[model samples]
Target: MSVSPGIDRTTLRTTVAVLVGGIAVILDSTIVSVALHQLAQDLDVGVSTIQWVSTAYLLALGVVMPTVGWLQSRLGAKRLWLAALTVFLLGSVLCSFAWNADSLIAFRVVQGVGGGAMLPLMTTIVMQAAGGHNLGKLMSVVALPTAIGPILGPVIGGLILGVGDWRWLFWVNVPLCVAGILLAWRLIPADEPGRRVRLDIVGLLLLSPALVGLLFGLSNVAREGGFGHPDVLLPLVGGALLLTAFVLWALRRGGEALVDLAVLRSRPTWSATALLFLTGASLYGAMLLLPLYWQQVRGTDALGAGLLLIPQGVGSLVSRVVAARLLDKVSPRTVAVAGFALVGVATVPFALAGADTPIWLLLAALLVRGLGMGMVVIPLMAVAFVGLERPEVPHASILTRIAQQVGGSVGVALLAVILATAATSKGSITSAFDIAFWCATGFTALAVLLAFALPSRVGLDASAGGGTPATGAPPGPAADATEVGKRASIAS
Candidate 1:
C-alpha cells in the first residue's frame, strides 16, 4: 500500500486524482497556443483579436492565484477542488461552442478561473495528505503534468488540427474532467465545512490588480516598443507599487490578509522561491526561444518543433527517479547546484549553435537540458513544504506558486525584449538567439548561487519556520511564473 517512505495508499490515490484534474488545466494552457492561427482564420477574426483567447486565460490565472489560500480556508479542500474542476469543465464545454472571438475569449477566462485554483490547490492537497514526508519522491509524482503538458500540448494540438478542428481542443478536456471528478468524489476523504475565515476584500483588491498588472505588463513586452512601450512599462510600475502596498498591509494584518506573509520567514522557502525565479527564466525563457529557433532558423513546422522538444521532456522524466533517490541521500543544495550547473552547461550548445548545427546534437543537448531542469525543479518544489504545519501548506504553496509564475512571465518577457533588441542591433537572427540563450545561461548561473542558500537538506530549518502562520519574515519572492509565456508552470 506504500510506494515509498510515507507514501501510503491514500496519499498515492490523492496524488493520482489531483494530477488527473490538474493535467487538464496544464495541457489546455499550451494546446490552444498552436491553434491560435487556425482559430483566427476560422473565426474570421484578426490574429490580434484571436490572441485574446490565450491572453484572457493568462490574465485570469494571474488574478486568481493569490486568492487560492483564502478560498481554501472558506470551502475546505474537497469542496473547493470539486467546484473549481466543475467550473473548468463547464468552461471547456462553453469554449467548444463559442461562436465568436469575444465569446471564446470570455470562455477562456472562465477556464482560467478554475485552472488557476487547481494548480496551487493540487500541491496543497497532496502535501497536506502526505504530512510532509518523502517530499522529493512525492514532488516528482506531483509535478509530472507540469513536465509533460507544455512539451506535449503543442504536439497534441498540431495533430488535432491536422485531423480535426480547433474546438476539439476544448472537447479534449471533457473526458479528463469527468474522470477526475468521479475519481475525486470516490477517493478523496471529505472534510467538514471549512472555518468561517473572513475574506480580505481590501487585500484582494490590491493584490489581484498588482498581479494582473505584472502579468499584463509582461505579456505586452512582445508587442511594439518592447519593454519601453507604455503597455509594458505602466503595468510593471503599477503592479510593483500595488504589490508593495499589499505587503505592507499583510504585515500589519498578520495572518488575516488575503495571503499570509508569515511563511516566507523560513529561509528555505524564501530562498527556494528566488532560485525558482531564475529557474523560471531558465525553463520558460528558453522554451520561448527553442521552438521558435527551430521553426524560424531551421524551417520546421510547429509539429516538428514540438517533436524535437520531446527529448528534453524525456530527460525530465528520466531525472525524476534519480532525483528522488538522490534527495534521500544528498542535500537539496547539492542536488540543486549540480542541477543548475548541468542546465547551464547544457545550454551552451544552443548558445553557440549555428543554423546547420546538427539536429541530433541539438536533440542530445535538449535531453541534457531536460535532465538538469528536472533536477533543479524537484528540490525547489519540495523544499518549500519542509517543516510547515498542515494549515500553512496552502500559504506556502501560494508563495512559491506566485513566485514562479511571476518569474516565468518576467523570464519570457525579458528574453522576448532581449531577442528583439539584439536582432535589430546585430542584424542577424541567429546571433540574437545566441545572446538570449547566454542570458538564459546567466539565469542558471545565478540560480546556482541562490541554490547554495537553500537548506542543505530538508528539516535543517524546520525549527525556524515551525510551519506557523506568523512564522517567517514578510514574503520575498512571488510568482515563480509557470506556464509557457502562457504564465508557464511553477509546479511549486
Candidate 2:
C-alpha cells in the first residue's frame, strides 16, 4: 500500500489503537467536572471533600509523569502500555463501586497513575513508529481527543447524570479500556527491553513531590483566600524548593537522570516547551472564561453553555487537515506564528464584549479561535520531537507534558484571580469577564512571539532507518536500527 505524504497505513492503525484507549482518559479528565456537585450530594460529603476526587487524580498524575521514561526504559513500550491500560481499567471498576468519597478519591489516584503514563507514552510510541516523519499530521490525529474532550465531556457527563446514576461516569470507561487492550495486543509490536536500565530513584523522589506540591498549590487558587490562603502558599513554596532541588540534581546526574534535563539543550525542544507553556495557558485559561461568561453574564445554564462551545470544537476539527498539510509544507515556525496571531486577533471580541453582545458574533469568534488553536498546538507538539533522537523522545515528551500541565494550572489560577479581583472592584460580571479574557489574549499574544523560535522547516528524514534527526540527514547507528524495526513492521 502507498503511504500518504504524512501518516502511512501502519502508522494510522497504531494511532487509532492508541487514540481509542486514550479517549477514555481524555473524556474522564473533563467529564467529571460537571458531576462534582452531583457526586458531593450522592456521596453525602461536603463539596470540598468531593473535590478531592479530582484533586487526588491530578496529584497522582503529576507524581507518575516523571517516572514514565524510567518505566518505559525498563518495561518497553508495549508492555508498559498494556500494564497501564489494565491499571486504569481496574481503577475505573473500583471507582464505579466506591461507596464513599475517600474510596472514590483513592480509586481515582489509581486511574491517574495509569493516565499520566498513557498520555505522553501515546505520543512517544507513535513518533517512534513514524520514524520522526509527518509529526504535524500525526499530532492532528492525536489532538482530536484533546480538542473535543472539553467540549463534549460536560455534555456527556450531564446526560449520564440526567437519567442514570453518578457511578456511570466511571463505568463508562470499561468498554473503551477493554477494546483498547485487545487492539493493542493484536497490533502493537514488541521490542527489546532495557533490562539493565536502572531507575533514578533520587530524581523521582524529588520531581514527583515537587510536581505534587506545585499542583496542589495551584489547585487551591479558587478557594476563599485565593493565592494568599495558607493551603496555597505552603505547598507552592515547598514545591518550589523541591523543584529547585530536582533541577540541581537532574543537572548533576545529566543523561543518567530520570528526565534527562540535557534534552533542553536542543533549540527546537526548548522552544517547543516554551510554546507549550504559553499555549496551555492560552487554551485552558480561555476555557475557564468562556463557560463562565455564558453562564454568569449571559444567564445560560451549564448545558446551554456547553452547546454554545460546539462551534469552537467544530472549527478545531475542520483545521486539522489544513494545519497538518501546512506543517509538512511550510514549517512549524510559520504555522505556529500564524496560528497564535489568529488566536490573538480572534479573542479581541471577547475582551471587548458586553453583557448583551450578540451570541452569533461570539460564536463566530470561537470558531476562528478554535482554528487558530489547532494550527498552534499541532505544530508545536510536532516540532518538539523534530530534532530529538529515539532515546531522547521520552524525555522530550515528559518535558512538554509537564510544561503544558503546569502552564494550564498557572493560567487557570491567574485568570481566576483576575476575575475575582475585577468582579469585586467593578461589581459587574461582564466587566470581570472582559478583563479575564484580556488576560487570556495576552497569553496567546505572548505565544506568538515565542513561536518564532520553532524550526523553520520539517527536516526530519522519515525514510532514514533508525532514529533520524530532524535535520533530514543521514541517520546514526542507533537511529538506523530503530528505523529498520519501524520499516520492517510497516512492510509486514
Candidate 3:
C-alpha cells in the first residue's frame, strides 16, 4: 500500500471527534471578547461585573488544569471528556437563559469548569492515541482549534451581535456540542480506567489558588493604576508566593506530586514549555493588538477588523501541510528557528504600519505572520513528548498548557500596561501602538535564539516504552502504522 502523507485514519477520526466539541470552547473566548460592551449593556451591569464573564472562565480553566492528570487516571479519558462536554453544553444552555448579570457570571463559571478540563485532556487523549508517532504532523492537526478559533470567533461574534440578541452566542454552541457528543461516542476507542491515583490534596490547595490569584491579578492589570493597583498587586504577590511553595512541594513528591514536576527534567520538555511561554505571550499579545489597531487607528468596526484578519488565518492553514512535511526532513530546531524568523519579520510591518498603511500590504503580512505562528506549535509539541512515558504525557500536557495560558495572561497584561502608558506620555495613539508592536516583535526575536536549545535529530530508542520524539524525518513508514489506520477504520 502507498503511504499516506498525512495523519493516519484512526488518529484523524479521534482528532475530529475532539475538535468538533472543542472548537466552541475556544471560539467562545474570542467571540466574547468582542461582545463585552454589548453584554454589559444588555445585562444592565457595570464593566467590573461583566469583566468577570471572561475572567471567571480563565481562572476556572487555570484552577482545573493542574489536576487533569489525577482526574484522567481516576475517571478514564473517555468518561471525563464526555462529562466535561456535557457540562459545557449544559452551561451554554443555562447561560442563554440567564436573566441577570449575576446569573450570567455564575453560569460562566460552570462553562469554565467544563472548559478547563477539556483543553488539556483533549491533548492528553489525542497524544496517547497517537502513541509517539509523527508528532509534527499530529500537532498541525492538534493545533487546529487554536489557529481557527481566533480567526473565526470574532467574525462569528460580530455576525451574532449583528442579530441584536446576545443570547444567540450561547445558543450557537448547542448544535456543535450535540454533534461532538455523537461523534465522540461513536469514533473514539474505549479503554478501561487506569489504576486509581491518590489525590494530592496539599498540591491542589497550593497550586489551584496560586493559578487563580495570578490570573485574577493579571486580569486587572489593563485597568486603573495598572499593576500597582491594590487588586492587581495583592493577587500577583500572593500568587507568586503560593506558586513558589507548590514548586518546592512538588519537588519533594516527584511523580507523586499533583502535576509531576519531574517531567521538566527532560531537555525537550523544559525547553518547549519555556519557549511556548514566550510564543504564547508574543502571539496572544499580537492577537490583542492587531484588532485594536484596526478599531482604534483605522476606525473599522469589530466585524470589519475580523474580516481583514482572515488572511493570517489562511496563511497558518496553508503552512501546516508544508511544515509537517518539513519535519520529516530537518530537526525541529530548524523548523522553529525558521518559523520564529517569519514571525519576527512579519511583525515588523505592523510596527511600522500607520493609519494610512495600505490595507492590502497589511493583509499580506498577516499571512506570513500566521505561517510562522502555525509552525511554532508544531515543533514545541513535537519536541515536548520526545522522552515522556504514556503516564508522563498527561502531566506534560497540563504543565505546558498552564505555562502557555499564564504566559498569555502575562502578555496581555504587560502589553496593555505598555499601551496605556505609551498613550498617556505622548498623546499620540499612533506612536503608542507602534511602540507596542515593536515590543511584540521583540518577544518573537527572543524566541528565535531560544529555539536553538531544542534537541535536534534526537534518536529514539523504541525498545523501552518511551520512544525518542520523532524529531528527525523517519526512514519510511513503520510496518504497523498503516495497519493501525486500517484497524482503526474497521473498528469504528
Q: Name the TM-score of candidate 1.
A: 0.93
lDDT of each: 0.80, 0.79, 0.80
Position 194, candidate 2: lDDT: 48
Task: List runs of model 1 lying over 4 Å from the truth.
Answer: 1-6, 460-492
Instruction: Give one digit per residue, the lDDT tens place, for model 2 in 287-346.
Output: 877877787778876677778888888888888878988865787899999999988988
Clashing pairs in 3: 460-468
How much lDDT does candidate 1 score?
0.80
Worst ten-residue run, lDDT, model 2? 476-485
Model 3 earns a TM-score of 0.92
Model 3: weakest 10-residue lDDT segment is: 475-484
- Candidate 1 vs candidate 2: the lDDT winner is 1
Off by over 4 Å in 2: 1-6, 460-492
The predicted structure with the larger TM-score, 1 or 2, is 1
C-alpha TM-score for every candidate: 0.93, 0.92, 0.92
Q: Could you tell me the lDDT of residue 119 within candidate 2?
A: 82
